[model samples]
Target: MGDTSDFDRFYTDLKETEKKDSVLTSKQQIDRLLRPGSTYLNLNPFEVLQIPPDSDVDFAKKKYKKLSLLIHPDKNADDRERADRAFDVVKKAIKMIEDPDELARCRETYTEARARLAIIMSEKRRKQKKDGLGDKIPEDEPAAYNKALWVVVTKVFADREKKRKMLEERANEEKRRAAEELVAAAEKRRKEEEFAKNYEESRDERRGTWRQFMAKKARKEGEGKSLRGTAFRPPKLKLETSGK
Candidate 1:
């Protein structure tokens, strides 16, 4: 009975190990599938939540709210490792599709990817036609095509987003500088106007004082002459000379 119990315990441990190994294998596969360069499949909240491409504005907002809550770092603290990665991807994807320029870039990337895929497919078809094996085309070609397209799309969108952020920063800097310049110019103009007004007022005050002084002197001369009613003569002074 003791041997049997030991065997059972060993078997249970083996099974547990096998289960752990299976889980690890699955995690590895998921990591590989969602690798950094996967594609431009917009990992945004809306996209991640599988909102339709033509979803209404309100619906998109709702989708974002739902997904953000689910993947928020705070809410998924126990699984923060995965949640953070997913959140970052979602954030980047949202920003990529939000701004007009970024959206245009996304569309351009998609177009370019499609064009490249079409060219490759065309070449393959031509080759098959030439060899009379057109009917033997692989069923997985479409998947391969999509994978390649997305890879390019993702890279282009990422690059464009970086550039867009840089441009936005530059624009903000320019706006700040312009605002500062305008304020400085306004201050300078105000100072100049004030200085001109003060200078003009001072000049007028000085002119009035000079005119008043001249008037007072003239009035005093007239009064003296009127009081005397005649011109006054100067008295002669006696001079005493010493014997040389």
Candidate 2:
């Protein structure tokens, strides 16, 4: 039983080693075949797409479609796993390069990456100079050392774009809310004005009725006084009694 267990462990280890070796072989092939350089092939999207740096929209779209089809996983099923990763890279590159907004973001990312690389290289150079190895250090290696810089730069730009869009949406929402508030305020003012106009008209009408009522009462009192003044009085009742 122990012997069988040992054999099983050895088989598993051997299989793991073989798998590791295969993965390593694939990695080496990818590095050798796909790596871009300044002299041979610039990794810049325009260069890879075989278009001018200032290519128009139509050209960019064409290049993106062509590259997508070329590196599509279905077409490269023999290495579908690697092909899928490559396709993703190509897609990201297209996104970073095609749209004007995305292109601007990419340029900003490139600038930041260059600045960071400069800082790192400057420190390295400073250290080398301090150690009396300045003569051995090469200045042409900064660009070469920035192999993974694009990945970092792209992420930063993507994050910035997301935040910018969120801010724009928030601003739009605030503007919409402000507009609604203005409309509501105007409606309230309209209602208030209407109420004030109706109240003023009603007050005027009541004032007219009160003035008419007062005039009518004054006229009735005058007539009653006149009638009392003009009334016939029983005059000489005293004289008649004296005759009797």
Candidate 3:
């Protein structure tokens, strides 16, 4: 709300006022830092070291040392293994946040969280104003940021899954259409072959009919010539018979 540029100032102020001289026992540290869902919670370095993103190098160093002493494996001999694991996480947190680049990245995520919160709250207030309700939108920070982060995460995953399904559907449709086209082409080729074969058979039948007609015409012409020859020979045969 006011000068929320970085969490370093917040961490400095919180360290001086909140985590100053107070020291927690190893068991207490374990309960607070090594709880069941701590693994996911500790993903954020700021959350891991229990410091703000705007924390300075001095503050990060102090917080790291404090946590180290509290959860030192050697100190917590009864639960050495868990203590070591927790200590490693704290050590990593300090190392990561101390770096300028990593710190900036953390700040970016926090800022993004803030931006999302603003959008959500603005929309909510707009709706309330429309409904004649007072604009009493929630002003929870870092927490609102977390909510915003979740919204982005869920949207990204949903969008990716939707795209994947659409791509799969497109591939399936293309495959189906290709199969249909292949079948149609095969049917077309088969019909063409059938037509060609029938055409050849019909041509041969016509040729045979034409040959038969030509042979019958030739025989009729020969018979007509023989009849003319017989008519010419008839007078010779009658005269010979009368003289006898």
Candidate 4:
């Protein structure tokens, strides 16, 4: 008998532990929904609702009602704090599922995950066959397939979030630049207006200064004309003959 692959061994163990999660109590459900890293984990609506990606909107709505009621703050008075957070998560998930675009995107992510998993399985199986091992792949089973799909979907979501953050940063930078330019333009306009106002307000001063300068020049000219009109009589000359 061929030795079982590690991949197969994992699923074997996982299958043993798989239980019907539908019977979990309200508190257990709350804890599960609010677990560490649940922010990223709950991004998947199907993951949040604990439903299959292929589940229709109607089925999702039913699941939403159940989970929402279970974790609703009013219903879980003793644990209302955590219950509120959990409720919001469930509410957001249902909204996404209800959105036609979001729902389609969720389905596409699953479809892409499945397609990629199929290719990977085919390669693994081919390699196993070449090595003289059986062509069986663990992920061929439903449980293993679901786990693999979850991993793939998580990676896809992470990648999309990174790209979105980058785009948002770029958009924010553009908006900042636009705001700065607007402020700079406004300041420049304000300075120009102030300068014009100051120049206008000083108009009378400048005109008065010009009139004073012209008046002084005219007064000097008049004094020169009066002096020139008088005869240049040398101060009455006292003729003193030099006595030899």
Models, CA RMSD each:
13.8, 12.9, 14.2, 5.2
How does each model score on TM-score?
Answer: 0.45, 0.44, 0.50, 0.77
User: What's the ranking of the predictions by lDDT, best on top?
Assistant: 4, 3, 2, 1
Candidate achieving the largest TM-score: 4
Taking the tens digit of each residue's C-alpha lDDT, what string does model 3 give over 59-166? 889878887888899899999988888888888788878788877766776666657657877898899889998887554466444444544433433444467689
Sliding window of 10 residues with minimal summed lDDT for model 3: 11-20
The list of candidate 4 runs beyond 4 A from truth reads: 1-18, 118-137, 218-244
Model 1 weakest lDDT span, ten residues long? 24-33
Q: Please report the TM-score between candidate 2 and the true structure.
A: 0.44
lDDT of 1 by residue, 67-177 (tens): 556567787676678767766765665665566675565456667656766666677777888998864454237654544554455555566657878999999999999
Off by over 4 Å in 1: 1-75, 79-109, 116-140, 208-244
Best by lDDT: 4
Report the Cα lDDT for residue 28, model 4.
Answer: 84
Model 2 C-alpha lDDT per residue in residues 1-244, reported as the tens digit of each score: 1585664564354335434432434343333225433222324454345454456767788867866676677877788887776666666667657668866654565677667766766787789889988634454565345333543443455556668789999999999999999999999999999999999889978999999999999999999999989869787655344554
The backbone clash count of each candidate, in order, is 0, 0, 3, 0
**RMSD (Cα, Å) of model 2:** 12.9
Supply the global lDDT for candidate 1.
0.60
Model 3 segments beyond 4 Å from truth? 1-23, 140-244
TM-score of 4: 0.77
